[model samples]
Target: MLTKTVHSSTDAYTNFTRKEWASLAYQASVSLTDEERTQLQGINETVSPDEVEEIYVPLTELLYMHTKHSVNLHNDQNRFFHRETKKVPFVIGIAGSVSVGKSTTARLIQALISRWPNHPKVDLVTTDGFLYPNHVLEERGLMKRKGFPESYDIRKLIRFLSDIKSGRKSTEAPMYSHLTYDVLKERTQHVEEPDVVIVEGINVLQVNKKDRRISPVFVSDFFDFSIYVDAEEENIIKWYVDRFKVLQNTAFQDPNSFFHRYRHLSKSEAEDVALSIWKTINGVNLEKNIRPTRHRADLILTKGEGHRVEQVEVKKS
Candidate 1:
């Protein structure tokens, strides 16, 4: 595989400015409606039709090509072996720091890619389900390190991915509730073998296999493609704080909300708490864990102020 940086010698990626990338959207085959976009938008984030047309449409087209190539590769191998096997799911991994909008990215990608005519069954899941239950985190005294890699059940996450990649007809994953801020006991999401499976999380692209002690296998080992959402650290801090403020008025206000106590905080008090969480937890995790995985991604979306992707960088195949 050849590699080259566009118009640059030092960078590893072929950089594409927003407009240059948007030009390729003339080939966009999926047609999304405004209501669908609204459903996919994240809290305290902006995702406009222009952003989808310019960024995601072309990105989806790329994923479709990859999926097709994978199917053909399997067919070719089977011909040589004189045996047939079922088609495996084409997995996509999405990773980024919290509040960077990776969730929105995953949802938008799933919606767009499922519109493809050939194999439209696309299922999306997040690694949050693989996080250790709140009780376990508390027992281990890891409550403050909630989103850190060590907080997840890596073995279970790998098992789930293995089943999907192996073309299992049906698999079940535990579901987590934000209101309860914990994994549900009796609730599970069923996943049927699909043409594409999207796994999104903060530490999704972390190079976990380098340390064998970490896990025998990584969840990303099965990914056909990976994307990393990126933004300046300060910008993410601001977004996180802003999102906290919004949740205070909504989810946090519910009496049953895990954070209900925070709902009545004065505006100044809320800002203080938000900043504390960012500086002590999220910011530290980003610097020590999530940000280190950025270069591992095949494609990177660099978001600017207002969460609009200002530039894209793609690794050469």
Candidate 2:
């Protein structure tokens, strides 16, 4: 059974400790390798193989179970309608603030879920791809709010999801390059028909709550399941600053890097700038856009120091 600390004010999710959620895996074998974990790590974001065995293995098993049930439900609905509609891909959305490690979580999900029986195909796409191109952001004077909701091309993102949910055999999803810090003008990632799709982004769960009556669908409407990766603001700030420093030593040193100017900054100067950006941009965006959607997720993974998931909370079915 899960352990929860609910007060009179809390009404929805039944919280689970890491151990309790791990038990749901029924002791499944660890199929993810160290090399795979290495591939999944983002800058300053490291996911150990042990964490995969303990945390992600069970999570993916549960998701696979959910996918099977979702397929059956889709079939049942089709039967009721007297139509032969094909089952859509099971979409798993991972949402959180910048530097909260949702991208690595999404990649691990794709890797682990693909190892399940039938070796079902899974495609992981980051919604950074859905952000408006640099020129577009510049034209709109939204360069400072690059990761905020207003910086995204929502119509394009909605159409992309609509295509997959409508069972289109193929659709193109644009790719965002961290090195260039822009959407590649000539490149696009193809979302071929797949069994599962894992989408990671800060705004994946942000829905239009005020205009729901007029809006036909929100971006999160396509998700079969959603996980919100969360941590204390202080921890996320540290991670963001640490990542910025790492980027300064690595990607920012490249002549073609969009952040090349940062590579020349002294250590203290870099730290100051990182903290300032977090305080002004990322922090404010979190309060206004990201954190508000936490309750909309099916599961919440709260992290402790050292970026470990300390607890899991699942909303009642």
Candidate 3:
């Protein structure tokens, strides 16, 4: 049985020491490879393969089990939905603060889970594709809050996810351009039937919206499993500033980049801009939206000062 202890008054939620959490994760069903260990080293500053094995490996396994159980339940309940019919894809949601490495976690899980023999066909999709087109956001004067929940076409995104979960033979999601920070009008990426689908974004689990009727169909309803990567707000701010500086020196230098002008700023100036954006936009979104949903997640990976997952919290079913 999994064991947990309450850590503090501020966070009464049950927490597991990293080692205990890692062991439980293995019980849930993930395998780690040496190649993945090598790859993880390059992205994570101080994390080791042992850490991944203990944390992410078990998390992925739990997700695979959840997916398998969901598919079985669906097939058994609806006799007509047999193996011949496409199996409903297992939908997983990853949510976290900006620059907290939620995207990296999603990508890593996608790669890891796909290697599982039982789930060979895995596809990863980001909620970035669901964001309103730049023109639309600009017209609505909401361009600055691009990652805010309101910036998304929630209705269309719900419909798209519903279609995929219904086992549609094929579906398409709008493609968004990171370089230009806009939706590509004429392009869409087709999603074939897959064993798993990962949906990653900053606010993948938020249920509160002004549209009360559609709010009932919140994104969390579509997830078979969900993960929330967590860290101190201050740490996330530091990460955002550091990553912004890196991008400003590289990607933002591109003429076609939407943030190209930021490349001209001095290091201190760039840091100020990054911190300002984080404080005004991403930070507000986290406080008002994302962080509250942490309790709703099936699993939570709590990070330390270095962004290494130091503890984990798994909800008891």
Candidate 4:
């Protein structure tokens, strides 16, 4: 059972149990077919129809409210300055540790938001594409730190966001392939004036020392809203290992997969490899880079066993 907490006026955030949060869907409800729900779920992640109706439906409503108000404010400012009314995408940043189901949450939110009559064109972009190509990481001796802040082309990411926020007609982002474990140099995701843009990544909320000094803007600067997915470290490790094992049996079997060699390993051997990789890489990155930024998010979704969103924390305005 989950314990409910009451928020004090002085508290930085208002906390809500899953039941309490689900009630916020009072306005309008959207249902997803099993096929749509399945398409949004990540590997080793299961998102039930109930979860979609109870959690994400309300979330979509809240985002729609913000998006509507933001447009109003933008129009007000444009009228004040006697400028033409232009539409800018409401950018939402989602950050969390690897294997914590942030990708699924992002995709779910994107799907729901798009269904709203107000915002039909919702674009989902993952920051995996912003990561330095495998060859670049190899040259920099940062292959092991691939998801760390330094491994991304921060400037390029900033410029991409800048373009979207500036209301550019069309912009392109590099594409990354999990099968090849590298950026596909030949391909790109073309985003054309989307109503809402969801930028999902493990390092979306990171603010490194150099970024504070050398860079004039941070990635979060472009966000109108942001979310961080939270779960126990042990749970995340278990999920990571479980996902790795599933990949070993499936995607790793493909000869073209970067991890194709992993398919030949025995089950126990694969588990050991996953554990070693987690402890040395993903775990370290989470502790040092990702988890620290949780407090910075406008909303935090805390998950319990089985990837259930047990609690939510909304920052007080």
Candidate 5:
């Protein structure tokens, strides 16, 4: 096993301002090029280069180190195996509440890590593909709880991850349609062997349940490292409201969108609807299912009111 202290004693987890945290992040072990820094400049409206350096740079460094160690471990284990066996992919999981910017983080990390000299091939897959078809959700009366753990095909997701980690030559994941808010039957995405594979979702770290017995092997079991994006509940609620309005005027306006009706609501009416959905659905799911997994993450990114990452909590191993 590789042993080294990962966190610094002077690292501030909760006391630093966003800019101060960002400065410390840039000083971490990871190196970022000027071109990459320029590319990161476009992260949403709230995230900045400083925040990326402070929050995501440290995260990417930790993950890269863990992945390197995992590769070494796998190579050692394979010493007794035949030469025909393929190398296993390094798996990472990212979890967070809705509107907390976990998707952006996942995408950003995938971009950054793939550019690393030691790991040139990286791929990203999301658990949204494992969500139950819209018709099934409607039949089960779970349309309002779309992000809940029960809304996903947990067994299929586990099996898919298992196959990918087993060094399968190719694996297929179902495609989810934002326009229909459901899984597309005829559509699938193929994943080949990669140096790194990031699986992201609201509940990617949740344990599996089979009838009355809890399975020991969870989705997180496949992860070499995991991260959780966190922000205050009030701030997340505000973000949900703002994003819902933007989608209402844009994607929701598409005739085939599952939320097409929302596009017709007045601005104030839409805000009210958005807040209600956040409170009744997303907010409750975050509290009951998502937040509990925070402690399981190898690292945590805490965001401030401005939506920039203000603190990083890394578990000392």
Candidate 6:
């Protein structure tokens, strides 16, 4: 159980250490096997089964509680308004720096939430697909600032979220190919009446000032819940470089991969390239755009060394 020592004095949030948070895991209804847990981890991510049990289990239980209440509220409101009750998917947004393990967190939550008998259908989508196509980015001279807030098609992303929230069937999102470093025009992720949708990306919680006057709708406006993963910049850089080295030997080796030209480089050279990219591109975006939006998330997961979640902060109700 969380103690007074773990709680922050601030009115905005209640903070808890890992052990304090884990004590709530007993409330989690489902468990995962080693294989299932392994499958949820991202490349070079250091999450373990024990970590999943201690961290994500209780988190999913909380999401379930929120979803149940949302459904009940929707039903009561519909009856009061004399309108037909409709199923609206509970949308969860996960945001963070490029290598901060947001994807792993989203996947783990989706897996755990889907295992429940009531909400058997859960879908996960990455906002990489919402990014402008490579040619468009090149034309707009945004290729260098690829992951920044201006690089996304905010209007399209909002429309997609709008359709999902309205319970529209067969809504589709563009598919991005990391190997090709581009969007596949012919491929799309078709989402159909899911019980829950988990949207993961660095831009999910970003607020585009450019769109505020024109649209008045931010990307996170449709989110029922939001999570921000946090880690020190140095640690994230190390993880990014490590993942780059692994990709150099694996994905970069594929001739069709956008980064295939770098596959022949020595490990040191690969690490240098990764470091340069992080410092100039990803790190700049994280500092300027992503990290600033961390305060907007409903929950923040702070990671320490070895990509372990050391603490959690939940918005105080």
How many clashes does each candidate structure show, in the order listed?
0, 0, 3, 0, 0, 0
Q: Which segments of candidate 1 are over 4 A away from where they belong?
A: 1-10, 209-213
Over 159-276, each residue of candidate 6 has an lDDT whose tens digit, in order, gives 9999999999779999999999999999999999898999999999987875554477888999999999998787888899999999999999999999999999998899999988
lDDT of each: 0.87, 0.85, 0.79, 0.88, 0.78, 0.88
lDDT of 5: 0.78
**Model 5 residue 150 CA deviation in Å:** 1.2
Error of model 3, residue 41, in angstroms: 8.2
168-190, model 4: which lDDT tens digit per residue? 98999999999999999999999
Which scores greater on TM-score, model 5 or model 6? 6
Please give, for residues 83-169, the per-residue lDDT of candidate 2 as tens digits: 998788999889999999898888888887877877888998889988999999999999999998888887788889989999999
What candidate 2 gets wrong by more than 4 Å, as runs, is: 1-9, 78-83, 209-216
Candidate 6 error regions (>4 Å)? 1-10, 211-214
* C-alpha lDDT of candidate 6 relative to the true structure: 0.88
- Model 6: lowest-lDDT 10 consecutive positions: 1-10
C-alpha lDDT of residue 293 in model 5 = 80
The true-versus-predicted C-alpha distance at residue 93 of model 4, in Å, is 0.4
Shift in Å, residue 207, candidate 4: 1.2
- The TM-score that candidate 6 achieves is 0.94
Judge candidate 6 at residue 221 and give its lDDT.
96
Write down the worst ten-residue block by lDDT for model 2.
1-10
For candidate 1, the C-alpha RMSD (Å) to the true structure equals 4.5
**Model 4: how far residue 138 lies from native, Å:** 0.9
Can you tell me which runs of candidate 3 are displaced by over 4 Å? 1-14, 25-47, 78-86, 212-215
lDDT of 2: 0.85
TM-score of 5: 0.86
